[model samples]
Target chain A: MANGSGEVVRNRQVIFRDYVSGSPEETDMEVRESALELRVPEGSNGVLVRNLYLSCDPYMRIRMRKLDVPSYRESFQPGSPIIGYGVARVLESGHPNFKKGDLIWGITGWEEYSLITEPETCFKIEHIDVPLSYYTGLLGMPGMTAYVGFFKVCSPKKGETVFISAASGAVGQLVGQFAKLVGCYVVGSAGSKEKVDLLKNKFGFDDAFNYKEELDLDATLKRYFPEGIDIYFENVGGKMLDAVLLNMKLRGRIAACGMISQYNLEQPEGICNLMNLILKQVRMEGFVVSDYYHLYLKFLETVLPQIKEGKIVYVEDIAKGLENGPAALVGLFSGHNVGKQVIMVSRE
Target chain B: MANGSGEVVRNRQVIFRDYVSGSPEETDMEVRESALELRVPEGSNGVLVRNLYLSCDPYMRIRMRKLDVPSYRESFQPGSPIIGYGVARVLESGHPNFKKGDLIWGITGWEEYSLITEPETCFKIEHIDVPLSYYTGLLGMPGMTAYVGFFKVCSPKKGETVFISAASGAVGQLVGQFAKLVGCYVVGSAGSKEKVDLLKNKFGFDDAFNYKEELDLDATLKRYFPEGIDIYFENVGGKMLDAVLLNMKLRGRIAACGMISQYNLEQPEGICNLMNLILKQVRMEGFVVSDYYHLYLKFLETVLPQIKEGKIVYVEDIAKGLENGPAALVGLFSGHNVGKQVIMVSRE
Candidate 1:
C-alpha cells in the first residue's frame, strides 16, 4: 500500500491489438492494468483529463483500414489506443483557459485518463442543464452532423418530399425531425418494426417502413412518394441508393451522409438506376459534417432553442462500463442499438 | 415538276418499327410514300411549310422505347413521320406573327413539307449574316443545348478543371469552347484521333484524348485531372461516368446532358464507385436544355458578342443535297462527320 501524495492514478487502458480484417472480435482489443502518475507536466500547455463517456460511430470502422487517399480521418495505428470524440472532466490543467474540475468535450484517448493537446477544438461545458452524457451523442458531433447535412447541404424547401434511409440511427433521427420541422413530408426506412414505430411516433415522421420486411424498395418508395421524392438523405448505399435514384423528382436533391451498407463488403454492389438522375433532372450532393464546423455557433443558436422548447427529442443507447465499448461499437453494423451508441466509462 | 401555285405533295416519311430492341438498324425505319395536300385546311390556325433540314439528337434513342414514366417529349408514333427540330420556310401561315416568305425554325415533319399548329415555341429568324443552314446546327437547338447546359447547369468558374465526353459532337464541341471562353482548363474525349485534334486545335480545348486508344478511362481521367475534376459535362455515360465519379473534386458539379453510350444498350452497364461521391462531396445534376429557353435572349446577349468579335468559331460538315440526309443522319453513330452535320435542303 502507498499513501496518496496528491497524485492519484490507475493506468488501466484499452489497447488495440493487430489490425482486423472482416468482423472485429473482442480479442482484437485488450485492457491492461498498470500504474500511472496523473500529474500534469510542469509548463505543459495540455490538459490531463478523465474520460467519462466514449462515442462509438460507424465511421470508426473505416479508420481500421489503410486508405490510398487521405480519408475523412486517418486510420488507427495498430497496438495503439483508438481515439474518438468523448465527454471528460479536467483532472489537471496546464493551460490558462481551463482549470481542474472543469467539464469539457473533445478528442480523448480510450483509457481512464488522457493527456489532450489541441484544445482549440474543445468546448468547456457551461450549460449543464441536460445530462452531461449527451455530449457523447445528440448534443455533440452527431447532432451537428444531422443539422449541417440536412439544412446546409440538402437545402430543403417547405412541402418537399423527404426520405431517409437507416432512419433509427443517430444521424437519421435528427434529420427526420429537422425535415418535419421544415414542413416537409418525411418518410423513413428502418431495419425493424420497433425502429419504424420510433420514427413515426417519436420522431413525428409522416410515414416509416421496415426495409427488412419490404420485398421491393422501389415499389415502397413509389407508394410513399406518389409524385416523387424531392430530397433523399442517404445513410445507407447499395440497393437502397439504386432504388431511390428511380423515385427522385425533377430537380431532386440527395445529401449522401454515409454508406453503411457498402463499408464492409469486399466488392460493393453496382447502382443500376443512376440514369434516372439524368432523366428526372436531380441533384445529388455528398458532404462531411466536420467541414462545416465553422457554422457551429449558428447551428447551436438554432438547435439549442428547439431543445429547450421541447421541440427536438433525442434518444441514446448507453452501454455501461469500458469493457462493453468494443461490442457496442461493433453492434452498429447490425443495427442493434436503437439510437446513438455511447459507452459510459464512469458516472462522474 | 411543281410550281409555286400548284398543290404538289409526295409524302415519303420514315416510320418507327414496333419498339425496337438491341442496336437499331436502318431497316428498322421504313420510308412510305403517299399523296397529300400541301396546304393547311381552311379555318385552321396552322402553317404548312416545306421541311429543309432535320436535326438528329442522341435523346431520340430514348424516345424509341416504351418507358414506365413518360419522357420530356412523347415517343414517336408507329407509322408517323419522325418529328425533330428542323429549319423551314412558312410556305403558308395561319398564325399572325408568321407569314409566307418568312424563314423560321421549329419542330417539323421529316418529309418534304408539314402542316403544323401551335407555333408558340417557334420563332422567326432575322439577320441572315451567315449560312441559313447554320440555323439547323450552330444557331438552333444544338446551340441552345451547348449554351444552357454549360453556363446555367454547370455554373463554370474560371481556371476550373472541366471535362467533356463525345467532344466532337454538335453540342459537345460548343460546350468545350464555352468552357474555354470562361477561362477554364478544358479536356475532351473523342472516338478518333481526327476528332481529338479538332477538339484541341479548332475548338481550343486544353487537352484532347482519343478514348479508343486509352484502354483505362479512369487512368485517362486521372492523368488529365490529377487534382480531380471540378466540372464534368456528361454527354456519353456508362464507363465514362463511372470513371469521372472517382476523379471528382469536393463540391464538383456534373451536368448530365446525355448518355449516348447507354442509348442502344439492352441492359446498360452499372456504376460501382458512386460511394466516392459521399467522400468527395460531389454534385451530379441532370437537365434538359429546352427547359431553360426563357434564357434565350440572355444566351444571345452572350453569344452574339462572341460571334461579332470573332471570339467564337463554328465548324460544320454540310451534306450538299436533301438526298444525302439519310446517310448524313446515320453517320452520327459511326463518327463519320467531323463537326455539326447539316444538310442543305433548299435555298431562298
Candidate 2:
C-alpha cells in the first residue's frame, strides 16, 4: 500500500554476520542490497531517512559481542543492518514533529535508508553551517560524549593536568581541546606518530606521545606529567588504565568514556592498579552520552561558537562509501583511522 | 629530659620485621619489650599516651609493603614499632589541643605506650559513655569510614538495593546498618556462615551470603538482587569487584572504602568486568575516611544515638594482649576474623 511518490527502492546495508568472540574481522559484516519502501508505514510514528554518514566508534565493538548482561545500547541483530550514530536526511515521516527534508543525527542504520521506529531518538540538526558529516562525530553523539565526560564527569579545574588515552580519536580529540580551553595542561597518547603530532600541533594539547613507542607506560606518564595526572579521559583501557592509575594525583578524576583495548579480547585484561583509586582518592565514573542528551542544547550553545571561531578543531577520517563500511569499522579495532572514523554513505 | 612525675617504664611493642611481599605472616612482626620515658619532652608538642586498645585493620597490610608511588599512608617503617589506629590515655601532653588525663583515638603505635608527635591527627574522646574499645571499631576511624562511604559516597536513596562485600568487617557491618537505616534493601557477603548470620540477624541486612560457599558470585548476586544493586560498599576487591560490576544497576555507586582481598597480594587480581561500569553508567569512587574527618563530629552526632537506641550494632573480634596483635592483624588477609579485629593492649 505505497503511494506513487513512495516507491520501493534498493537499500545497500551492512549486516552483522553473528555475535563476535574476539577481535572483529571484516568478514563479521556483509554488505548486502535489500528493498525498502521510501515511506514510514501507515499509522506508525516512524521516520524514513536517507543515511548520509555512519560513525565507527570503539563502543561499536562491544555491540558486536553477545551480551549476557543488560547494557545501555542493545546488541546489533545478526541478520539486520548494523545500527549506530549517523547523519541522515528525512525522506518521509509519519510523526507530527517532521514532514520532510529535516537533517538529523542519532541512532540510525548503517545503510542507504533507515526506517527509524523511534523517531524521538533522532535529533534534528540546527546548525547546518558546519559540515553535515560533523553530526556523525564532532557536533553529534561523540561530541556530546566528550562534553559530558570531560566537563560534567571529570569536573576539570583550570590549571589541572589532564591525560587522555586514544587522544586522536573522536571523543578524545574534543576532550583535549576542551581541557585546553579551560586552561588545563593536556597530554594525549595515540598509537601513531602522526596522531601524536596532530594532538600537539593541531589539537592544542600541551604534550603528546606515541603509546606504541613507549616501553613502560607508567614511566612515560611520569615523564609527561611529573606531578601526576589530575584528570584521565579513558578511551583505551587495560595497560594504559593500569599505568594511568599509577600516575594519578590525589583526588584525581577518571572519566571512563570507552575501553577500546579490552573490547576485542576473549577475556579483558586484568586492571591491577585499581587499588590506586583508594590511595589517591580517585573517582572513576563511567557515562553513556544518551544519559546527557538533556544537556544537548546547552552543549551545542557552548561548543558551536568554539567550532566556528576555530578555538576547537576536529579531524575526521571519512571512508567514501557504505561498501567500504566493514573495513572501516574493523580498522577501528586496529587503530587504522587517524581521527573520527566515518563511512560516507551518500552525498545527497 | 628528666621530670619529677615522669618515670621510665617497660613498653611491650610489636615491631614490623621488614617490608612484606605477599601474604604477611605473624613472623613479619616481632614482639619486643622497650623502655619508654612516660613524658612529652620539654618544649615539644608531642603527647605521650598509654595505648589501651589497638585496631587491627586491613589497610595495615598495604603499609606493610614497600610502596614505590606516593600514597595516602606511608609505608610501615621496618625495624620500627608497628603503627595503627588505637585508643589511648594521654599521660603527658605539650600540645594545646590535648592535655594529661585526656582519652584519644587515632594513629598510635602498636605498643604499651606511644608518644604521638602529631597530636592533631588524634581525636579526643568526647563521649566516653560508649565502650573505650568501641573507639577502635564502632566509634572511630572504621565507623567514620562506614558513615562517609555509605551516606556521602554511595548517595543511596530510600527503597534502593545495596550490596556490601566483606560485610562482617569493621566498616562493612556499619555500612550495612547505615543502608538499612536509610530504608534501602541491603544484602551482604562474608567469608563464613557466622558472619553472614551476623549481617542478617544483628545488622538487620535484608539478605546475606557466605561468598566462600557461593561458587559463582555473579549468579549469587543475581539471586540476592533480582533487580540490580544500587550501591556497593566495596570492602573486598579482586573477583568480588568484578562480580559486583556485573550486578550493578544503571547509575549504581560503588564506594571503594577498602580492598582487603587485594592488599596482601603481590599482584592484585585483574578486574575483568570493569567495562560493566560504562555499560551500566555506574560510578566507582575510592575514598579515604581522613578526607571526610571534618564531618567526624557530624558523624558522631548521627551514629552515637543509633548505637544507644539499639538501631545499630557492632561486632568485634578482640585479641587479648599486645603479643597477639600480629596474629590479629595478619588474620584479616585470610578472612579468619569474624568481625572487627582489635588487640587489647591494657585495660587501663
Model 1 chain B lDDT-worst window of ten: B1-10
lDDT, residue A114, model 2? 94
Off by over 4 Å in 1: A1-8, A12-28, A32-45, A93-99, B1-8, B42-44, B319-331
B249: Cα error in model 2, Å: 1.0
| lDDT per residue as tens, model 1, B33-151 | 77877666767677878777777767776766767775576777777777777788888877778888788887876776777786667767785776676676667888898988888
As for model 2, its CA RMSD to the true structure in angstroms is: 1.7
CAPRI accuracy category, model 2: high
DockQ per model, Cα: 0.67, 0.88
On residues B13-85, what C-alpha lDDT tens digit does candidate 2 reach at each position? 9999999988899999999998887877777788999999999999988899888877998999999999999
> For candidate 2, what is the DockQ?
0.88
CAPRI tier of model 1: medium
The C-alpha TM-scores of every prediction are 0.92, 0.97
Best by TM-score: 2
Tens-place lDDT digits, model 1, residues A1-348? 112334766866677776666766677777776666786766567888899999988877777766667656787877877788899999878777888899988788788888887666777877688788777777788888888889988899999999999888889999999999999999999999999999999999999999998889899999999998999999999999999998998888888888888777766678878778778888787888778878877877788789889899888899998878778877888898998899899887
Per-model C-alpha RMSD:
3.6, 1.7
Query: lDDT values of the candidates?
Result: 0.82, 0.91
Clashing pairs in 1: none
